[model samples]
Target: MKTKTALVTGASSGIGRDIAMILSKKGYRIIMVARRENRLLELAEKLPGESRIIAADLSRAEECFELYEKVRGEHIHVLINCAGFGILGEFEQIPLGKELEMLDVNIRAVHILTKLFLADFTAQDSGYILNVASTAGLMPGGPLMASYYASKAYVTNLTIAINQELHSAESRVYVGALCPGPVDTEFNDVANSDFAVSAMSSKKCASIAVRQMFRRKMLIVPGFSNQFFVFAARFLPRRAVIATAEKIQSMKREEQNS
Candidate 1:
């Protein structure tokens, strides 16, 4: 009997690591992808099921394609796109190179990997894709983290659109977006932002994400608060939503500096 395999990006730490662990416990052979080989090795040793590690920086287009090529032949039962980062600052103050890198990892890499794997999944007629977006994506804009917010919006919208296409085609390939709010992870340090509200545990976030994703839910926002925010944003005027987002981000930035 062939073992089902799940490939998880950003598996070095945080939500990705937690998701990988949960999937491993669920009897899926895990393929961990991240830049930190040592961390991945440590995690692989602890996982209950068999695991493989691929140390590659998905922020580079070449590496993203290379990763696809390496695993294209494997029967991947699931692909979780979670390798992403964010920078918090005024759009004009942020480095263009960093913003581009963020786009590469958060959007371009996701697009490439999804396209590659979706083809395979459709051919096999069974697979699941979970793209980790953010509650920020539901907002009209984010003042301090413009690029990051926009990138997540792309991820969220893209995943939803693809899932619809798959449904219309009558394919069993499930594609969904995990839109978590602030999570208690290294992401705060990496993004250079402070949480304005209480952050949810990455383990809790991952648990909900995995369960909802396999259940074939299209947009899995982890917490009730986050879901409410997303829902309310839909009713608010676009300008008002953008203003609120800006105020929230401004507060976060001030907290980070203080």
Candidate 2:
């Protein structure tokens, strides 16, 4: 059997990094992508199998296109769109430029890469694409972190639609969305937010995500509580869901201010 290769974005830290490590241990060569070249180099050294590093800022459209070009021929058996960040603040209060950047990474990047690779994978009739979304996307809306939540919702819904398309076509190409809740990673630090609930370790989150990806799960919501939240949201009134998200995000803002 030919050795499989996986391309993982946002691999410098957090769930992306953990998934890379896990894939390496599973004997898949990982092509790590992130803006932090030094961090990628360090992770490459630790991997049990072969690895390559591509340092690119995924927020830029050209960079996202270029990234796909760089690795498409490598026969990547899996593509993990794990490169994304969120900001916590009132929708209007946050700088528009920053929100755009976040959307570029969280929405645009994921959209572009998924579109390009889905074509390739569908043509070959074999591959897996795991998009790292969030439980924030599952809810109706978020209050303080409105833009961030909306960005994730785009990812989640996009993945859902794509999965439906692939299934309708009876295609073997697998596409899934990993909608994990607050993970104990550098995410909160970078997003300038606080977790209202205890954060799960990145290792645990990655383990579940990768495992579910292999199992062909459409929506890989990690924790039981998170699964429940997503399910419960469907039955709750839209306004109530928004209000709950408001309380959670409001706590994050309060913590940041303190």
* lDDT by residue (tens digit), candidate 1, 142-181: 8878899999999999999999999899999999999999
Give the poorly placed runs of model 1, Cα more than 4 Å off. Answer: none
- Compute the lDDT of residue 25 as modeled in candidate 2: 97
Candidate 1 versus the native: TM-score? 0.98
What TM-score does each of the candidates earn?
A: 0.98, 0.98
Assess candidate 2 and give its TM-score to the true structure: 0.98
lDDT of each: 0.93, 0.94
